[model samples]
Target: MGLACAVAWLAALTVYDVRQRRLPNALTLPGAVIVLITAALAGRGAAALLGAVALGALYLVMHLTAPSAMGAGDVKLAIGVGALTGAFGVDAWVLATVAAPLLTAAWGIVGFRARGGGATGRIAVPHGPSMCVATVAAVAVVVI
Candidate 1:
């Protein structure tokens, strides 16, 4: 039930992100809180919180250093995404965190090329979808 909810939450966020290019705090924050609590009940609170902090911090740094490339919403979304993967263990968390940017970069490169390579000075690819995908993928890998 919790897993299904998380999947639906991520799916909704993914759709919103692709359409609007923003991950609203209302959704992201609540999801994080729910997942964190769930993780705690599941006896993985500390590690889950650490995962949230770790991935959230990483995205925060990216947002701070390159605001154009990373958004504040993505930073917020990372917390929940991290916790989801973190519930499995460090391996899932690390894999999700590492894969997110790579997936986003791939999207950026492919999108840039598809757009004729220089129509805009920068590609505005949203990172939330990639983050969500990475979390799902990592958890799937770890679990199966």
Candidate 2:
């Protein structure tokens, strides 16, 4: 049940971020609450809490130091990702965190290449899809 909800939330977030290039507080805030509540109900509250706090802190620092790279919405969405993956275990949470930026970087490179290698401007790539994919991949590994 928790996993399903998490997946659904991720799907919605991915679509929204891809379309708008922004993660709205309206969705992310409520999604965080749902993930946390579901985690607690599933008897993984400790792990979930730890993951949320750890990832939230990590993203917060990134946002503070590199505002242009990380957005507040991404920070908020991290809490939900942490809660979902953390419910599985610390390994899942850690893996998701590590994979997200790598995935984003890889995607950005692919996109850059696809657009021809002559452009030198900064491209705005949505990080939410990377986050969602990493979270789902981590969860799948832990669950199966």
lDDT of each: 0.90, 0.89
Q: Write candidate 2's Cα lDDT for 27-138 as tens digits.
A: 8989988888887887988888888888999999999999999999999999889888888998899899999999999988888888775667447688989999999999
lDDT of 2: 0.89
For model 2, the stretches where C-alpha displacement exceeds 4 angstroms are 119-121
Q: Model 1: number of clashes?
A: 0
**Model 2 lDDT at residue 15:** 98
Q: Candidate 1 on 1-144: residue-level lDDT in tens?
A: 888899899999999999998999989999999999999999999988989998889889989999987889999999999888888899999999899889989998998888788657457788899988888889889988
User: 41 in model 2: Cα distance from truth in Å?
Assistant: 1.3
Model 2 residue pairs with clashes:
none
Model 2 vs truth, CA RMSD:
1.1
Clashes of each: 0, 0
Error of 1 at 91 (Å): 0.8
